[model samples]
Structure formats: structure tokens, C-alpha cells
Target chain A: MKVPNILKKTVPVAVGLVVLGYLTLYFVINQTPQWIPENLTRLARQADLLENPEAKRCFECHKEIYAAWKKSRHAIAWVSETYIEDSENRSKEKCLPCHIPRQVKNGEKPQPRLDHRDDGIYCVPCHVIDGKMHGPYDLFSPPHPTQKNLQYRESKFCGSCHEKTFEEWKIAGVEDTCQSCHMARTESRLVQKPVLSWLHSKKQVGDHSFPHGEITQEDLAVTGEISGKEFIVTLLNQKIPHRVPTADNGDPRLYLYVRFLDDSGQEVDRFKEILAPQQDTALLYGKEARFQYPLTAPVRKVEISLQYKPAWSKDKSEWRQLSYPVTGDSG
Target chain B: MRTSLINSLLFTLMLFLIPLQLQAKDMVVKAPPESLGKYYPPESKEPKWIQQMHKMSGNLGGVFVNLREKDWDNLDKNADQFVESYKEASEMVPEWEEYFDLKAAKEFAAAAKTHDGEKIGKAVGAVGKTCGKCHADNSISVWTRFHWPSFHKIKITDPIEEKELDFGKYMGLLSGTFKGVTVNFKEGQYDRSQKALRAFKSRFMELKSTCSKCHTTDDVKLFYVGENVAQAFDGLQKELTAEKPNPGNFWKNVGILGKQGCKNCHLTHRSYAMIQERWEEK
Candidate 1:
């Protein structure tokens, strides 16, 4: 069969163009942007003494992320009353670095922020490193410089401050990273301003509240029984990586109160037990806190309730009550 | 023919482009780091006191179960064993008598003699109350105990009073008060004995709250220390209430309180520094 010269010439050129197109697309999509903004260079000049204004600058483009982080524990890490009390009126020097970290060091302790101590763990510490704003994506940003940092995607970024928690997470052997559970993205939105939304692709933005105390009643499974005048209430720490009421700087507590009532529902006696930190009160991940109370009187009913108090609260006035009918032996 | 070839070439390019777009959209920098290892909590080794307490509880449970079944012989046997365990426990930590009702064991024994199911049930319940009282305070099982240090020495500082209290000093005070009770009782000075006993009880109550400071749970079991102190006071009160003071019973109670109540806890929790080191690692 005689092959036409035009067909032979066209096929090779077409295949070459296709291969080149694929290579170009791959390189552009995967490669980090080398462009550095002139304004970012000026901003980097004061990066050593970077303050809340730098974070506010980020808000100019990332409004939603800023709003979410504003309400987070990281926003008020240094200024929170609970943190103040726990640090013994801010006298604890060791605790200062994690809360107001100036730099996020890999496999090393974070350096304390000298300038914006009040801002606590704001944007610059995690995002801005060596004069560049780093994140998970290598997308285009006209106003500032950006780079893709693999550390941001890993739990190591959280580990510098959450050392014990990081260790616990490592020990837990769960495949999920800290961000997978704590910073799970809620909505897909443009990463930049509304005007530039058309320029950038819509992506899932991680929730920045970093919610740890949003545990619902459903998360804790509780059961009670009356076995020979002893009211035993068992609580299982379910759907959490760390222990129930886990914290690094604070003493969170789980209070179990059992009220014995007479036939007429009059109060007979009461028993109370507290589960706290260090004194071995914390229920380990997937463990149970079994509380046994002896009925002092001939009770018609036993009403048991569990209240979880976060480390910030002085008393258990605003307790998150678990919805469990811990009542046993009705008349 | 030219138009057809151009169409085919465009179709081939579109297929490759589609996948590239999808890949770009879904591409993350990297998957998260692999987990270091599974968290295996320290294995619990049941302490001697906890082991003995478990046996006592088992026998008590048997008594209740047998009573419910209306098995009189089994009830009697379990009741006897339960009382015997109670006695042995009392002997092991006699100071626990004040917190633990020794009378409950006697009541159980007396009811067992009658062999009446209802009476035996009531007796078993009373005995259960005594066990519950001790167990309630010392609720941390051998399993949970492994999570904690064997000894916790807490220092309480009062900001308003500007005073600092070493928990070790309070323990010393408790020991001294107990010694006073013994010394006074031996001298046959019933009034002095009673006064010292009251001081010992007051000191113990103060120390009880202090335990919660260092301990994660307020349910820390002091191994019958509180009960023992309470027993000594009760004995002193009985001596004072009687028309003729019987020094014999008071002396016997003091001896038990000193030997078993105070010393036993010290023996179990002697390695404070070592235990603290272990707890800090966790």
C-alpha cells in the first residue's frame, strides 16, 4: 500500500502537538508559582515584627477564612481568661511559645511571637515563613506571594504547639490527620476576593474555628443500672481521637451527679464524682468511665446526669448535659 | 477527508485534557503522614488491696445472688465468706472501720443465722452499703490505677492567706495526731485521748480535700485512711459515754488504727518520686 506524503507528515505533527500540550498542562498544574509580589517583599521587611495587621491584610482577600479564624481558640490564645489562669497569671514562660508562636518549626519547638503576643496563634505564624505566604495550593495571587507547603497539609504543623496531642494522635494510629477531624472543610468557595472568584477555581476551604469542644451528647454513650443498691453509670468516650475532655493547658472535667429520690420524688441523698486531667480522671480514647454509687437510703428512683465542663469555666453552671436516662429502679 | 482527520485529532486531545482538569482540581500537595503506631495504654497490674477487695466484692455479690435464688445454704455460705472477708479486710486495714461499718458484717452474720430470705437480703444490702461506701471513694480499679502514679504529694497554696501548705506536712500532722491518741490512751487519760482523736479526725478531713488537687479524680481511695481515723474517734466517744471507762477497747482500736490505718497507705504509696516520674511520662 502506498502511503500519501501529506498523511505521514500530518500524523507525526499532530501526535507531537498532543504530547507537548499534555506536558505543558501537567507542569503548570503541578508546579509551584515562582512569582513573588513586590508588595510582599516590602511586607516581608517587617515580617520579623509581624503583627495582627498582617493577618488583617490576609483578610482583605481571604474574608471567610479570617472570619472563621477570628472566632477560633487560636484567635484568643494569649488573651483568654482560662489560658491566663492556667498559665498562673501568664507567669508560665514555657506555655507562651505555643500560644503566641512567631515561627512554626518542623520537629522543633515554635518560637514565641515578640510583637503580636495578643493575637495568639494568628495567620502569619503558620502561613508566612521566610517572607513567603505558604498554603496547600500553588494558585495565582496578584496582591501577595504564595507557595505550597506540604507541612500545612500534615499534622506536624499542629504538633509544634500540640506536642502531647500530636504524640497521642501518632499513638492513636488513626489514618486521619488533625485537619481531617478538626479542620474538615465545610464549603467549596473561591480562595480569593469576589472579583477574582472567576479567575480561581472553587475549592473546599477548611473550617478555621478548629473546634475541639463541639462534642454533642451523641458523641458520648452512657448507660446506667442498679445492681444491689449500687448505681453504676458507664460513659464511653466515642468518636474522638484524644481522650474525652482532653487539653494541653487546661483542666477540663466530666462531673457525674447521682440524685436518689424517695417514692414521692423527694431528694434522699446525692453522690458526685469528677473526672479531670493528670490525676488520671480522663477516659482514654475508646475507654469507659464507670462510676459506682451506693444508695444510702431506700430510694424509689435514681437520677444520674453527666455534665462536661470545658477548661475555661469556673464552675459547671453551663454544663453540656449528656442525654441519658441514668434513672434506675422506679417505684 | 481533511475535516474528518482534524475532528479525530481534536477528539483525542479532549480526552487527555479532561483528565488533566480533573487531576488539577482534586490534586492535594500530599497525603497526611502515616500514623506512628497504635496507642496501647499501659497494662494494669491489680494492687494487693484491690485484689483482696475484688474477692470480697465477689463474695458479697454471691450472697445477694443466692438470696434472690432462695438458696439458703449457699446464702449462708456466701454470707459467712463475705463476713470473713470483711474481717480479714478490717484486719488488713483496721483504720477503715470508721468509714466501713464493721456492724454491717455482724448484721449479715446474724441474718444468715436466721436463714430467712427477706432478712438475709436486707443484711446483704446493708453489707453492700458498707462495701459501696469504701468502693465509692476508692473506685479507681486496678486497671485505671495503672494510668496514675502510685503516690501523689500535692502542695496547696492559699493566695488570699498568702500561706503555702506542703501535703507532706499535713501527712506528718496526721501521723502525729494518731501517735497522740495512742500515747494518751496508753496513759489511761481518756479525756486527752478523746481530744487527740478529735484532732486526728479534723486533720484527716482537711487532708481528704487536698488529695483532689494532684489527683485527676476526687474519687481517690486513701486505702481506708479516712475510715480508720473515724473509727478511732468513735471508739474514743464510746469510752467517754460509758459509765466506767474501758481502756482495753480504746487501746485495741488505737493499735489497729496506727498499725493498719496509717502504715498500710504509707507502705502501698511509698514510691512517690518514682510514681511521679512514671505519671509525667504519660
Candidate 2:
């Protein structure tokens, strides 16, 4: 096989040009200002506009985080039926700030966004501070500028909206910060999409579901017994950090029902005890609640149950049972 | 023509190099330290007292199963063996002896002698409660190290309510049940202890269900240290319902439940914390 001089000269020249061209492109992408959508740029430029469309812009690059955030309670903070109902059909001015805050500033109460109200607690509200996106790490995000802020990594960041919970946490004196329990991280590569994954590194992604409401049956121990003509029911709050039925505005309630059954298994007597945030019966974390009822007649069996009502409702909604029935014999 | 081809090749090459130049450095950030302490008990050969404890647990389970099966002879045999093992362990760890109720053992033996299923079952439950109480008081710190990390890993959305699972409250339930079992047992309120134990078992099962969502069924079963512990409870239930319960064997089964059931799982999964620690170091 004979090799031509012209062909050999051209091959090296082509390879060298290709390498040099690629290097130029890379430098330009890394160093040049990231391209921003016109609408977001307009929003970011405005001083009075609290709601910035920049969050949607963020979604273009951070697709996975956006997807997770979309499902979180924060995403629906403005649209939830319960919140709307509790906030007097979204007319409550004070409540709107926390639910649809523009941005969280250190030691300052957040203000509601001027627009994009439906995007409650959107990405820009927490991530954007004075035109820069802040996060726990200062990673290279070519699409947007990022700054590392230690506050974003602390519980105080959550305290902006969850003031009462933060106070409760402080008084409880546990070492765990809000992120430790709520935003637990697992070892994995951060991005889910293939193209972007190549650019990103392995790190912990905060679970955006923000687990709440699923109660461990054992955490709240309820026991009942009839002793000396008195039916005694004891409720213990062993592990919850805040009150058993805790919330900023929701009126959660705990109900104890005691029913006495005769020889035929028919209910002969019924006694009810109610614990609510408004009724001064709310059980604090690591506290106990005891209710006693005077027995009027001899009964074959006494059945006791504990139920939880998330909030007060005008409709006759059945409350969820906290645990299985505890039955005791009545002599 | 040659000049044009060379220009085209240069253009193609430049485009390929863009990604290389723009590629971000793979960040290697340290994960935040875990808030709670990772308990690592001093490593040493199995102590004599621990071996006795295992025997006692196995005897407790044996008594329960034999009683349920109406094997009176084995039940009596296990119950006697458990009593002796309990005494031996108690003598070795006298400080922990106050937590054990020898009177309950004697009563269980008396019930076994009568071959009365109901009486024997109650006695066996009492003995089991005593064991649960002691474990809850003394062994909880060690046992929790294996299971607590799992709680952090669990995340699920409720289908009905469409809300996130309250992991904090769930943890509260676990710790509460763990605490309740001990407190009730220490008070000699076997009935309350039994209920608490049942609650603990139920919660543990519920928590274990989440494991399968992310893990294979076999992996979950293998990693779950509670399988044998649950089996021990089943043994207790059988003896509790048997027509003629044997106290001796029931007690022995309980000993196995404590020693092999709980201890084995802890030993197998002890590396979980160490692995987590290594990650932290990285």
C-alpha cells in the first residue's frame, strides 16, 4: 500500500484544527455569561416585582430537582384546598407571605411575590438572593450564576416559614437540624438526565417530598383499663418534636372514645374526650395525656380507641384511627 | 478543494472540543456529619452471660411453640432450662438482675405443671415481657444503631391522603413502643408489656414494608434483622393459644428470641454504621 504525501499532510492538519476549535468552544461556554430567557431577564431586572420567572429558567437545567419540587407541599402551598379554606379563601394577607414568599432574607420576614403567586415557595424564593442563586455548595452551573451561602444549609432557612416549629425545636434541645431529619441525603449521582449527568457530580439530593402525616402507630401509645369504677385511658407522645397535632395554622385534634359493651356486645355507655390545639388539650412532644371516666354500671367489656382529625371540618368527616382498639374487662 | 476540506475538518474538530473545555469538575464535597452518635460496642469474644441470655431466649420460644403444639414434655423441659439460664445470666449480671422477674418464671413453671394451656400461655407471656423489658432497658442503645438509619431512608407518599409519611411521628411511635415495653415490663404489668411488644412488632413490620419498594424482596428479608425476632413472637402466640402449654420449652424459645434472634441481626448488620462512617470519612 502506497501513502500519498498530500493525504498524510492533510490528516494531521485536520486533527490539529479540530482539537483547537473544540478547545475554543469549551472556553467560550465556560467563561461567557449564560444565556437567560428574555422573560426571566426582565423579571430579574425589575426591583419591585417579587415573583421572578427565573425559577422556570432553572428548571431547564435542573430538571430533576424541579420535578421533585413540583410534587412537594411547597409547590401547592398557594393552591391547596385546606390552605385556601384556612386562609379565608386566600384573602388573608399575613398568611400569603409565608406561603408565597418572594425571597427569604436572613432575620427578615419574607414578603409575598407581586406575581406568579401560584408558584408558591418556588425555587427562586429560596435560591435567589439579590440576583444570585444561593445554595449549600458553590458548584459550576454554566446556565446560571451560583453562590454558596451557609444559611441555606442551616435550619434557620426553614425557620422563615416554620417559625413555631423552629422555636419548638430550639426548646427541645436536640442536636438534629431540620435538614438532618427532613432532607436526608443518600449517596448517588445528582442529575437524572444523561446529558446533564455527565456535567454534574455525585452528591446528595434533598428529598423534596418532605415526609409528614404518616404516623407510626407505636409512637403514640394509647392504653385503657377499668380500675375501681373508673375507666382510665392514657395517651403518651413519646417522640414527636413538636406537639402531636402540630401546625402553624391547622387545628389538628386528637379524640379518645370509650364505649362500654354489655353481655350481648351492645354499646351501653359511651364517653368521649377531645384534645385540640385551641382547646388547651394539645399534647406537647414527649408528654402524656390521661382521661378518666366514671362508670355508671357494670359492663362486660370496655373498648377504647384513639382518633386524629387533621383539622376541623363542617362536614361530618370520620376521623382517622391512631391505633387498634384496646379492650379491657369490667368487673 | 483541498483548502475547503481542511477548513471543514477544522470546524468539526472545534465543535467536539467544546464539551471537554466546558465540562465541570466532578465535585467531591463531604457529607454533613450525622447528628446522632453511631454506637460501636467494644469488640470482644462472646461473654458467658450473653450465651446464657441466648439460651434463655431460645427456651422462651421453644416453650411458646411447644405449648401451642400441645407438646407438654418439651414445653416443661424448655421452661426448666430457661429458668436455670435466666438465673445464671442474672447471677452474672447482677446489676441487670433487678430487671428480671424470677417470680414470673416460677409462676410459669407452676402453670406448665398443671398443663393448662391458658394459664401456661399467660405465664409464658409474662416471662417474654420480662425479657422484652430487660432488652428494652439495657440492649436498646445497641439495637437502635442498626435500625435507626433505616428510618432516615424511608420515604413514601400515602395513596389515600396524598401526603408525605410522617417519619418523625413514625420514629416517635417506634421509640415510644420501645420505651413502653420496658417501662411496663419493669412495673411487672405483663399485659401492658405484651400490648407494647405487639405494637412494636407491628410498627417494625410497617417500616420493613418500605424496604421492598427500593430493594428486592430477598434483599429486604436478608437485611431485615427482625425476621427471627418476629418468629419468636409467633412462638409466643402459639404457646399462648395451645391446649396444653409447656413452660420450660416456651422459656427456652424466648431465650433464643433474645440471644440469637436479636443478637444475630445486630451482629449481621453491625457494619451498616461502619459503612456510613466510611462514607463520612470520604
Candidate 3:
């Protein structure tokens, strides 16, 4: 068989030129000064370029993914008040490893950020690593990306900062990690990465924007009921721990108090029960939390309220209650 | 010359038959299935209950399951709905923790058949309570017998947090076994490809020790690892019983280690990487 003139003479040269062009482009993209977007790069550079340089650089190349990451807990992991307090002033090595290990690991001598402490966890700490490339999720899978092993995509990476929560869940027989609940998705964290296959598929169905927004009352349903003398209140554990008012330590709980008022609105009969441990917290999900009051001189209406904590009485005489009024089912 | 050729042929046949005869004589047959019952008990039993409390709980459970299903459509509706669901189950179920597993299996199966995420969430939430109930009763045995296997099979409908343990040494020990197996496969001391295939097959069983710890078979194929591992077991058992083994007591010792160590299967990772790796298909 005779070879075509184009195939015989120019094919190898053309292939070589194509590969050389691809390499040149890859290097140029990496080295060039990227025009980072404001949403993607939260850092202002502030005259002196000291704090979170890797993040600054990351924003330059991956403006889109950077925007998504900037909105993530990882981006703000170091800035979160909860994480700061949990870290106990960043004195503990455990906290720093999870929150901002890369800076220390890479010998980047982190100078404190202005207006906000940069002691909390950051992005590159978990994501940037050197090893045989596994997919971000698959631990046992070999031949990982050329850049790094993708083990950071596992729940264990988050386990570093969220140890207490993780352990409590284990003790509680819960098998979920932080992303399982916090991300908008019910099962996974819905982590927004540029290369995620699901996101690619999701783009086909809807917008390419990663779902990042605060959940509001519109995102939840609140209802209350009354049966006989007992006021039944139900709140869905929609997107949180079964318990309301997510407290880390102590008994993170809600108080269910019911008050019966006559026509003139005098407190006739009252009952309060703390929805403590072993109490069905799911009534908040769909079931009814029943609180009882004795049948008195003909009750006009039932008023049910949920308090985060019990009434605090500093002095013997005066007391302040942080109780919030709840809308209840009538009659 | 013909006689000499016949004798030579007969000698070669005799040489082949000698090993076959020796191997047949040396083989040790397993005892009948009746004897196996002494080692493994049937995995079905009715648990004890708290009479009056059980009746109250049974009644309350019935009421809650009904109300819970109604509002499951509007999951994001009514914060009080969630509160009440938790209240009834948490307060009433402790007295009857022992009786929750079968009840849970039945409920979860029913819930799985429903195509709604909200209803499924509520049902899953209900299942979590049952887990708490069982956990409260017999922490060790409940975990060993039911929780670990079931959890390794559960498909978590949402992402959630896990707790950390201070047991670094214990974790290291567990990680060592995984590393050892991996190394052995790499070195080809064992059939590397077969082991990888076995590991992949037993992946669900491995997962049963992980996230599926809280789920049921009907809910998700979380324990498909169990099915995978079952395939590898026959071969592994043959190797375990083989003479002159490289890791002589590795299989028996690891089985014991697994029983004692919950964290081996119930790992606490910071991300979904480990789980994704375990469950993700090639």
C-alpha cells in the first residue's frame, strides 16, 4: 500500500509541533500574571503581600474555581470564629495542620493578615499534596493526577479540624462527616471543584454556578398545633443535626414552653420541657412535640415558644429570657 | 523392545498416580453443616422489651411514623415538625432499644420503595434514632453484630460530620494491615491482580465497616462491599489454610483485630476521599 504524501512527509513534524505548542501554552498559563477577580480573591494585597500567597496565586489561574472555593468553609476555615475558638487561639498544632498547614509546611513564613487573623485553616493545606494520583475520592485507586494524590477529597481531610464533631458523631453512632450535612446536597458536601464530573453533568441541566447561599426560613417549614390542653410544636431537622441550635459542647438543646392565656391575656397555666437528650428531636422534622397544661378557667389561646437555653437569673430578683415567640396552630 | 516400551509407559503412569494417591490420603475434609452451627449462630432473634413503656413507645412510634410521612413532602416545612419527630422518638424509644433493629429494617425497606427524598430523609432520620436506640442498649455487641455491617451498607442521603478519636496508635495498627495487604499485592507475594480484584470485590464488605454502618441493604447498595468481600473469602480461606504461608496467621489475626477495633471500619476522615475511593466504580 502506498502512503499518502501528506502522511508520509509531514505527519511526524505536525504531531511534534502540536505537542510543543501544548507545552508552551501550559507553561505560559502557569507563569503569566493572572487577572484575578474580586469574588475569587478575597485578599486585597494591602500594599505588603504577606498573608495567604498561595491562595492569591490560585485565584490568578483558576478564577472560576477560586470564586467557588473563596465561598467555601475551606477558604474561610481560618477566619471562622467557631474554628478560631475551637482552635483555642491557634496554639494547638492539630488546629494549624488542618487550618493552615501548607503555609508552615512550605516554609512560607505567614505574617498575620490585617483586620482579620489568618490563623485559621485555608484551602491549599488539604488540596496540595505530592503522591501517586488517585481521584480526589478514591483512596485505593492508583495512578493519581500528575500534580498530587487526591486523598484530600475524602471526608478524613475535614476530620482534622472537625475532630470533636466527628468523634461525637461516632459516639452517637452517626457515620457522616462535615460535608455530608453542610453542603446543599443531602449526601455529599457538593464541593465545587472545576474538574468535578457531576458539576459537568449538572451544567448540562442548570447553571454552572456552584450552589453557595445561606439557607433561610424559605428553605424551611415551621408549624405548631394544639390538642386538648397540650400544645404540640413541630420543627423539621431539615438541614442540621437532629437537635436545633447547633451547639458544639454542652447540651445543645431547645426548650419547648407552652402558656395558656385567657381573653384578657393573663398567664393561666404554663408547662415547659427541655427537649433534652433521648427526646425525639425529629418532631421538629415532622412529628409533634407535645407540652401539657392543666384545663383551667377556660383557656382562650395557646402560646408555644422555643428557647435556646433556660432563663438566666444572674440576681435573685431579676431574670433575662432569650426565648423567641413561635407561631402556633390556632384553636 | 515392545515389552520395554510398555513397561516404561506403565512406570510413568504409576509416577503420576502416586502423588494423586498421596494427596487424596492427606486431604482433610470439612465437617458437615451441622457442626458449623456451633461456630456461627442464625442472625435472627426477638429482643426483650419494657412492657408498659414498650406499649407506649409502640403507640407513639405508630403515631409519629404516620405524621412524619404526611409532612415528608415538605421537608423544609415546619421546624416544629422536625422538633416533634425527634421528641417522640427520642423520649419513647430508649425503653425499647433492643426491639428497634427489625422494626428499623421493616421501616427502611418501606421507605426505600418511596421515590421521594424528603420522605426518605424523614425515614432515614427515623432510622438514625433507631440506631441511637440500639447503640444505647448494647454499644459493643450492637455495633459488632448489626451496626458495623449495616452501616457499611448505608447510603447516607446527606453529608454529615464525624467525630475524631485520640487513638492514633490504634488507627496506625489498623492502617498497617491495609498497607501490608497493599504491599503484598505490589510485591506479588500473593497474586497481585487477584488480590486487587478481591479487594475490589470485597470493597462493599470493607465499606460495611465504613459509611454503610448505618444503612440497610434496601436503602442503598452500601454493603455491596459485603457481596464483593464474600467472593474473595473463599480464595482467602483456601490461602489461610494453605501450608507454609508467608503471613502465617495474618487472616485469623486480622479477623480478630477487626472484631476488637471499630475504628478500622468506622474511620473518621476529614473529607469524602476515602469513601469515594471505596465506593466509586472503575
Candidate 4:
């Protein structure tokens, strides 16, 4: 065969470009899309709630989702002991709206729902509007009266109440929406209330738990070392694209506890630093919160731990812990 | 003649005393007179009592309309026809025959022949009062006793144990299994709770077959064992058996299961079924 030099060279180059382009497309598409603060449509007060729909009514069909949401903090937000004490047994009306929020539209801060305060950011408030149930998809829920509102996919919809966290997320320029992490999507029938449920096709349904942090070892990078008289630990928000201990008006605190032990696992001395958004000590996106502690005489080892109080909780719970033994040596 | 009069007095006194004793003592729900059975199911293909009542009603209406038109011949015929039906219906129930105003009915018929509107009106009023009095005394009793379908014959094949069970026994078994879950869960017996929940889930799902048999209406069937109740059953079972089960959550889920899975159906059918069962037992 006659060798066509130009054709051979061009064909190889074209094939190379095609392969490279394919790889680029694959990687780029999988990367999380940056959070764009949507100019969400006003969940305007089109009408009052439909006869104060009970949470259990929503549960009749959304049983699985209800089960998940039932254990979530949102379910007991209004009834939580901390919330009650903090609000002075509901004497402070200003602290109420977000706890028992009304229709969560991107408008002014929502007013508290008058009755059914125990429901606390339930299905009807988030999904129902103006006598019609609104959601992310248009489904054939006959006689049920539903409208498709795509804004549920937007970050601004959640921003209506999570005002500060949404702002932090937007500033982080992460390629993910609040729904991406918190309201993780799974393919399932939207309404599982049967007979009617049989007719539905699988769709992306968000976790109704509005889940808390999915903190993993990789999400918060913890590294520790010890010097002659100082033990310095650096905790970085490596993977989570939002600030740690983030909330609107929440006081969830991340306490870094540094303890010195006399080689017997008995704490001899302890020091604490509160990392919270209000205190500007929260670990931010691609940022680190460092805690450097002094090792006194008779201290043979150091124990480091992070305990956290949830958004509406007053009780401290163990977040995570790690230990380092610098017995007569720096580790 | 003296003996006959004494017997009549004794029978009248007995009727009043019998009712009073029944009220003061056991206080059982009053069943309609046994003669009323001739109007209901198993004795008749349809409600013969209701049919006969409707027929008499129609005839009365015809008589009134004929009277209004001043059609003497038709009014006279209408009155005779009404009297005939009234007499026949009164005789249909042996005990009810005595309560019929047979003389008043005949008087109305006679008044229609006279073509005196005032006399006919008086006779009609007299007959109408008899009908109203009987209805006022007995209508609700008739409806309560015979109108609703009795749970007497509904035999459910309980799916869990795979055995034949009468409606009441089946209901007891189902509820007992559910109650086991509650009792055991409260006592921190998770294994027993899970077992009872498993049995309950099967029985509950199988109930749909029986429900669909009678509840042809989709909504009614849905109310008892539809997708919501089915899902609630399944979700409850899953939660009770989950690896990191939240005991409080399982309790909450059980409450939901009771509402949708048990209480809603009981609200619609239980009290009525209970009354029917009691009636049958007696």
C-alpha cells in the first residue's frame, strides 16, 4: 500500500484529541457544580395552609421519609428542651419563626406557623402552597393537587431559613447545592401511598431528614505533633465545602479539648477552645483551625478530642478523638 | 267474657312489664320484634319490609294527589287500593298486624265513597297518625338491627398461621399479634417485638385480599390496606429490625402503624362489627 504521510499523521492526532476530549468531559462532568445562589421565586403568601395539614397525614404515603424525618432534629425543633429554655418557654417570639417555620419560600423571613408547632418545618410548610402541593417534580397524583416547582432544587429555597449557612455555602464556591450533601438524592417513587403509587415512575427524591453533617475522616483533616513544651494540632476543613459549626442563629459549638496525662491515662490538666461561627473560630472552606497547647512538667502524653453541641442542643456530645504519646520525645 | 277480658289485661300488662325489666336489668340492645325478620335477608332475597313500606308510601301519595284533583272515582279507587296494601302489609308481619289501624283505613275508604272531602281528610289524618306512630317507635330499631351487613358469615383465612378463622377470631388474632409488639417492645424485648411485627405484617398485608372482596370502592379499600397502610406496615417492620434501631423511633413508628394500620380501619368497622358479634352471641 502507498503510504500517505499527511493522512496518517492527521488521523493519529485526531484520535489523540478525541481520547483527551473524552477524558476531559468525563472528569469535568463528575466534578460538583459550584453553588449558584438562585434568585428563587417568592414562595409568596398565596394562601393559608390547607386546614393545618397534620404531619401524620403526609406520613400516610411518605412512610419511609416520615420515618427518617421523625428522628431528625427538625422534627423536635419546637419541642426541644434547649429551644424551650433558650426561648424562655416561647416567651421570645423572635426565636420562633425558623423553628416552626411557615411556607419556606425565598422571600422575607417566614413567620411561625400558628398551630402544629410541633411539626417544625414539616412537609406541608415546605411542599404545600396556595391549596396545591408543590414539589420538584410534576407527577400524576390524581385528585391530590400538586404543582411542580423547580426551585426546590435551588439553594435559595433552603436559604429562606438557613440564611447564614446558605451565604457561607455560596461564598465557598463549591460545586454542590445544599441538596447535594444534606438532602441527598436517591431514585425512588415520590409518593408511596399505593394504588396511586403503582402508577409512578422512579424519580429523584431528596432525603426528608434534611440530614446533618456527613462528617468523615477525610472531610475534617486532623494532624497532630508535639514539641518539647508545645503540642500543636491542625484541623482542616478539607472536603466539606462549607464552614464547620455553621448555622443561621445556631450556637452549635465545636470544642477542641487538649489534655495532658501523666503516662497513666489520667488527665492531669485540660484546656478548651470553642470553635463556633459566632466566635469566628469555625473551620471554614479550605481553611484550618489550629490549636497549639503547652505541655507542662510531669506531662508525658497529650490527648486531643473534639466535642460538639448540635444546632439546637445544649448537651455536649463526642464528635471525635485522637491521641499522641510524646513520652520524652516529640511525635 | 270475664275470662277473655282478664287475659287481654294480662297480655297488655306483660308487654309493658317485659320492656321495663329489660331496661332495668341486663340493659341489652333491643332487637326488633321477631316478626320483622320476614322483611330482611336470609328470609327474603331483598328487604321485603322496606319494599312493602315503599309500596304503601307510593299508594298514599297517589291517594292524596287524586284527592287534590277532586277526581272522586280515582280518589275512591286510590283509597281502596291504599287500604288493601295497608291491610296486606300489616298482615305480612304477624305481630305488627295488631298495631295497624285497620278500622281507620276502612273508614278512609268509606269516606272516599261518600265524596265528602272534609270526611275523607279526617279519615286520612287518622290513618296517617297510625303510620307515623309505628315508624317513630320502630324505624331506628329496624335499621340498626337489619340494615348494616352482619359480620356473622365473613370467615377470614388468616394468612400468617394459614388457618380458617371466623371474623371475630381472626380480628382477635390480628390485634393480639399487634399488641404483642407493644407489650414486648415496652419490656425491651426486641426479639419478640420483631417476631410479632413479622407475623403482623403478613396478616395485615393478607387482609387486603378480604378487604378488596367487600370494599370495591378504591378509596375504602385504600383506607384500610392501601399503599399507605401497606408501607406503614413495611416501614415499621424494617425499623424494628434495623441494625442501629432507635427504640423511641420504633415506638413512634408503632404509633403510626396503629393509626393507619389498625385504628383507621377499626374506626370505620370495629364498633359496628362488635355490636353485630354481640347480637349474634346473645
Which residue segments of model 1 deviate by more than 4 Å?
A1-53, A188-197, A315-331, B1-282
Q: What's the distance in Å from true for residue B79, model 3?
A: 68
Q: What is the C-alpha lDDT of each candidate?
A: 0.61, 0.59, 0.39, 0.70
lDDT of 3 by residue, B1-282 (tens): 544443443344334323333434343322222321222222111121223334433433443344335444333332333334434434443544343444443464355345343444455445445544343333433223322222222221100111222233324433554555646744656644333333332222333322322232222332233333343454454553355443544455345434333333345331233333343332
- TM per candidate comes to 0.49, 0.45, 0.30, 0.44
**In candidate 3 chain A, what residue range of length 10 has the lowest lDDT sum?**
A310-319
Fnat of each prediction? 0.00, 0.00, 0.00, 0.00
DockQ per candidate: 0.01, 0.01, 0.01, 0.01
Ranking by TM-score: 1, 2, 4, 3
Q: Order the candidates by lDDT, highest first — what do you get?
A: 4, 1, 2, 3
Instruction: Quote the positional error of residue B226 for candidate 2 in Å.
Output: 47
Better of 1 and 4 by TM-score: 1
Clash pairs, candidate 4, are: A32-A175, A33-A175, A34-A175, A194-B227
Candidate 2 lDDT by residue in tens digits, A37-65: 44653543434222367456656656768
Q: Is the docking of candidate 1 incorrect, acceptable, medium or high quality?
A: incorrect
Model number 2 iRMSD: 20.5
Candidate 3, residue A26: how far the Cα is off, in Å:
12
Candidate 4 per-residue C-alpha lDDT over B1-282 given as tens digits, one digit per residue, 9 for 90 to 100: 544443443344334323433333433445688877866654543578888888877766666556556577787777788889999888887866766899988987887678655565556666776676566556645766777555665565565554668777888898899898888878878768877876777566656545543443446656666676666666766766677667776767777777886888778776667766677777
- In model 2, where do residues sit more than 4 Å from their true spots? A1-51, A188-196, A311-331, B1-282
Candidate 3 scores an iRMS of 18.4
